[model samples]
Target chain A: MVASSTARTGAGGQTLVVDLAYPPDPGRAPFTRADLVVTGVDHSGTSYEVRLYLDNPGADIDTPRDPEAGYAGRYTVFGHGGCYGDEGHCEVPEAAGDPTDVRPVHQLTPLDTFVTVTDALRRVLDRDGRLSTVTMVPVSLTPRRSDRSPAPELLEFADLSLHTYLAATDLDVPTPG
Target chain B: MGVRRSAASLSVAELTDLRDAFTALYGISDDRGYAFLAGVHGLPLPQYCKHGSILFLPWHRAYLYFMERAMIDALRRSRDDPAAAVSLPWWDWSSAAAHADGGGLPPGWLAPADGGANALASGPMTLGDADLEQVRTNLPGAVTDGADPVTVRDPDTPDQLPKATTVNRALSATSFTEFSQIVEGIHNGVHGWVGGAMSAVPIAAYDPIFWSHHAMIDRLWYLWQLSPQGADPSAALLDTALPPWPMTVRQTLSVPNLGYDYAAQVVG
Candidate 1:
């Protein structure tokens, strides 16, 4: 995977974005798993700038758990966590744009999807200029719990931040060839 | 290269060997030694744990292989037989889930600690107390990351156990991603079911059942690999290196490459 580094500077703040292009693996569809676009990265050497979690789907290795449960407004309690809905209906990364623009990945691989820090996190960029933490929500999810029937967060996640394996490495930084 | 058998199917001797081997490994304190085996799944940096990604099956397969190798070696030592026939066993929770009283907990795990080394109880944990903690070895020197490392297992945490039928459904998936979603979903359900120390993600490996549970999950994947419908990653996904993992997804697909098969599946 060859990548190029680019930082987007805006009035709000600076987002270190990396574009990663993976070579064709074999008989897979062309570009089906092509470029990985990561935004809101810290890009500073050492420490993690970005973290990716798969919610209940991609929790971690060795430990497998109940997917339907959560705790608190969003605290992961017992088998389940905070949400009162199902992770199945949540369309993340895509819905990242706005509440209504969310689209589900369906049975497709998440390779084409873009992952970014959803909102401004005070701790996102450390004093050293590296990303501190990132929390992702399905595009339609509001930090405040929704009282509707189709709430994706109702069953999607309490916290997925711990699922990533690439922490403490430059893997999140897409270096340009 | 030994076959992994179901715990219920193991003869008295085989079970004893497994218990002894685990006890031996559990007693070791060195990070690079036996503790390292379990720590691979726990702290000292849970670097190779691949969750929420395509490498889920492969990474655990490799990690299981290493731990199983350690078990086999330890078992051989326990029996003092250079050629001792010992292998790690798996818990068929999917089948157990079907039983009226199966999914609660394996009786073997809760066996009364009548002056015997209890594997499930974490009695006198030799790996730096019960925490199974570690310092960062990836860097030049070990340092505290100040991460919370604890283990918990609550029997009632899981809402539903993965039935054999559910696993069969996963096997029925036509795509690798589809199969993983269902299979891994069931996998997550069980982890939550065995709450307590098991509920904690980073330190769950400290529980004895964690290994057996994963064996079942790996066996399911192996079963899928044997089927004609089994899907392998295409070139598009092949190059996606499972970071912190030494191997690729394509490399971990073949069970034979790792040198093991399910005991029950082999017909001679």
Candidate 2:
């Protein structure tokens, strides 16, 4: 409902460059705030990407153009998960050498799906940590593959749940005071 | 060597053999190809999943069995030993071995020499469009071109992986949904723990350890089936057919009937 109308890039609204490789290889851990994370709170506080999970197949995710570019969808409670935080900031790097890379516009559905998944996510700090994640992706004007490339339907999404799981940090997600 | 053992009990040599076999499959780009093998996952055709549904345990059980058979065949052909019985090992991240060293990634997957080629991180891969589009155009039996990849950034941090007790707790759920979801929670944790190519749902199978990770998941389900609370699904769920997959929920319930089993009792 209440969200900023601008997609959060980096410190001063700059899109951060990230290297993505599949058949996953070892890389940096979620050691700092700069590392991309997934959560219920959006880092930008605005320009929210409304993502939908696999359970919902008939959800609307079309984003209005012009001044309402990224804010067409509902508040993306299931926060950012990939590198560069929000979907708006991530792009497939220019030089995709041997293993190729491409920036597929990640898509998300409008909010309203309730009781998503309420399961236990064990935490080293807490014994009974339950992970009740809210899912979201960018408001896609069209459908495509997980790579963010243009596809037919806008209903699909990459199962980036773990990215959200590993990247959850207190920095991005503020505690209600 | 025939059964799927825990990553902790495995020797570096044994892990190396599995690693090499996995890589060998990756090299095949045709039917029953490496990419095809990996494509049978969640990306393009996210259908017929044995998760959030009745087939969650059985479907994966069948998938793992098929994979083991493929590995056995590969080993026989490549090594020219008809008796090269090498079943993929399982990595119970919640176990002690996960906390041993470089996260849950065994030395074979991390070591530059042994599993270096098959090491998901050791190789160079450009992450982008080509991969997402692979299943739709290249691979077979995908959904209506609607799928997503799994997300993982760092795959070798030990602390990042789940503990054995964490998984044991998942087995305590009373209902099928509770048990499956908790099990999946652990499954998702490992994928994220071994982030990188293994993070995405579709491309996870490409990683050598993905099968092992899923094996652990499947094994947990097996353990549940043997428990007191575990029972057959209700009629509606049992009859529900997983699309693009010929088998129904009832068809995938048994591991013994599917042939092969996991090694040792993965005590909760």
Candidate 3:
């Protein structure tokens, strides 16, 4: 398996603080790059936007158009049924949507984006030597539902799935070769 | 006004008698017991079940609710009939401590025999330390050591299990906001799939109380759905897929087709 490594260093007496924003309540929805705020110390000590991209594909609700569209499509349907309606509009039933298409062609925030951003941050910190602590804040990205209402906020499930995803980035492991 | 009997007041014998009546009503026998029981629990047999699926919570809740309702109905029927010979018995786990302590005749308690030596009897006979260890490791924060506080009582009885007592206390002590917080703590990480397609996780079958615990969990989910605070947003998202066989919500919602119904008042 191919492994990737990155590091950031603290420069000239300044401490590098990595604040990872997460939703205060994780059960509401998942955090995405769109919900991120990455600021780090540059050479002049000014906070700059450290471009963040996760290693996973962009976050898209997986609505499969075909048989092979797989697990993502199923999750999309389930989530769709769960949050189909808005304040005034009635929720759409799963059957009301088009069939024969196993997957829906919706824009998705890839899981890898988080990994990529974390990798980049690690590399920068390793290079700078001013790195201090890393903090993660879970935040919510709006869902592209028909209602266009704000996505409900979420609290993270206290499970290994998300933790493992974050750990892979923290450790700077490459996508397994 | 007439006094009402709640699930919280059933005895173990009453619960067992109800189980038998339901089994008879459905023509269930030992040969097809698992499938019948699975139906009672709103699950397809393991052979039809997918590994690492999200159906765990909803499916099991449906199953237990069916059982609770069946038991409740049977008790009411028995109360109205002079010919009714069997009464509901409650397996009060809190009383187990006193029973162990040599206290005479723990109240609202019944011996395991009333269950007719079924799979649930194994729960009292063996501890299965290894299984308990796995359950502990996977599900941290389980109350361990002091006494076997996990009670399996007929839903119609008020016999209190220690764990149920604690849960009741927590629910009663907290304001609605605090209760919501407490529930959230328990509900977190609750949605996940365990085991792969090839391997089966036997945790569901480890004890008979697994059904009841899951029933309680489902009840919490129902309550959460109705809470003014809002349903768990994460729950709104489907992170998993339906199995290959095409199924619709209509197919799933029908009780006779599924072979059971939710207790009349429980869902309300």
Candidate 4:
């Protein structure tokens, strides 16, 4: 499903600030891993990076990329720059109209990106049982030569959600045969 | 069929063969040349390599196969022993050996050769007029500044590499889509962690280490396929063609059928 949220980047790039509601159930055991599940990332434009931080909204390209500064992690998008084909050629393919139809999805279809912020998440939780926010700063890279006059949209995505997983139980690990 | 061993397991003789193979390919500036093959992934007009897509795994599998065959052929032509060529060695980033230093890159990958430059560490990039023009116009200032452009790497600390738990988490995924997304996300992190040209798609392949890093990703997928919970992509997706290569997704499913297999594929 396509997410509705999208962030269009500007000259210095746009920073996405999200207020997170997490720690679903206090009764459950602590999470072993925390992943920032970014869904439906739009990479049809220039390649770029999105730096993730726990609570540092002011984080930018110059910000110290370390755990002490709330730096969680980052991921890069090797984009297509822009469609080089005829009109509609680069458009994301719509779902097959008929279930009987048998064709693979388009190669340019939007995909999900995940960044594991386990250490960062744990630090926030340990300090104040409840974690509150996440900051994602988008940094734009070079665009297609023809469209270089004005900066192009560098970042766009469908959704942002926090997914936490519990530690593996004894049953999950297999015993030696 | 030859077995692709981990970079850490390669013998001194095997390392010499790989270095020789790459050195031979470096001279040839044609389609079979290292620069040309690297360009097929990104840079110039068409970047055929699949990223952030379902075809990511299969496409790279085919690309690796193509490059290995080219390397083998080059070795056969250059040396007296036709068997001198060795299967490409993969950098097993998830192993303890890789986590030993601040950065896990194999010594051979970054080590100098003899008293000269190391082909594996870096190589010259010879882009055609058209490719060079594209770089100048669109990808300004991306290449290294020097008399000649060469592939470069600015890697991050070992802590930045994906942890073993993250890889195991990806392997536990039941569906191909979920598996692809998680693995690709990990793949993207490595690229970013490597930094410099490796971080960018346009010139990433030019770096020789790009091959080993990718082999690790491909190996993980192979392990996943062997797991009981693993399943192939949907029928329609399997039948789809991976562009720029004749092979389909179904064709890339079997590693042995492709004439190679990983030496140690025991999943953690």
DockQ per candidate: 0.04, 0.03, 0.02, 0.21
Q: Which structure among the candidates has the greatest DockQ?
A: 4
TM-scores of the candidates are 0.55, 0.54, 0.32, 0.77
lDDT of 2 by residue, B120-217 (tens): 33322212465445433432222223333322234445764665555555565456765665566456445544545554444456566677778888
Q: In terms of docking quality, how is candidate 1 classified?
A: incorrect
Higher-lDDT candidate of 2 and 3: 2
Model 3 over residues A1-177: C-alpha lDDT tens digits?
Answer: 112222222222121223222222332232111112111111111001111222212222222222121111111000111111134222222443667766522211111111112333333334543222332222111111121221212211111112213221112322110
In candidate 4 the C-alpha lDDT for residue B230 amounts to 76
Q: Model 4: clashing residue pairs?
A: none
What TM value does model 4 have? Answer: 0.77
Best model number under lDDT: 4
Model 2 Cα lDDT, one tens digit per residue, A18-50 = 122211334323322221222322211111233
Kindly report, for each predicted structure in the order presented, the TM-score of its chain A compared with the true chain A.
0.18, 0.21, 0.21, 0.76
Using lDDT as the yardstick, the better of models 1 and 3 is 1
Rank candidates, DockQ, best first.
4, 1, 2, 3
lDDT of 2: 0.45
Error of 2 at B160 (Å): 2.8
Those runs of model 4 whose alpha carbons end farther than 4 Å from true positions after fitting are A1-14, A20-35, A44-48, A53-74, A79-110, A115-132, A139-153, A162-177, B111-115, B136-142, B146-148, B265-268
lDDT per residue, candidate 4, B194-245, as tens digits? 6556656666788888888888898989999999867898898888887678
In candidate 3, residue B110 scores what lDDT? 31
lDDT of 4 at B172: 81
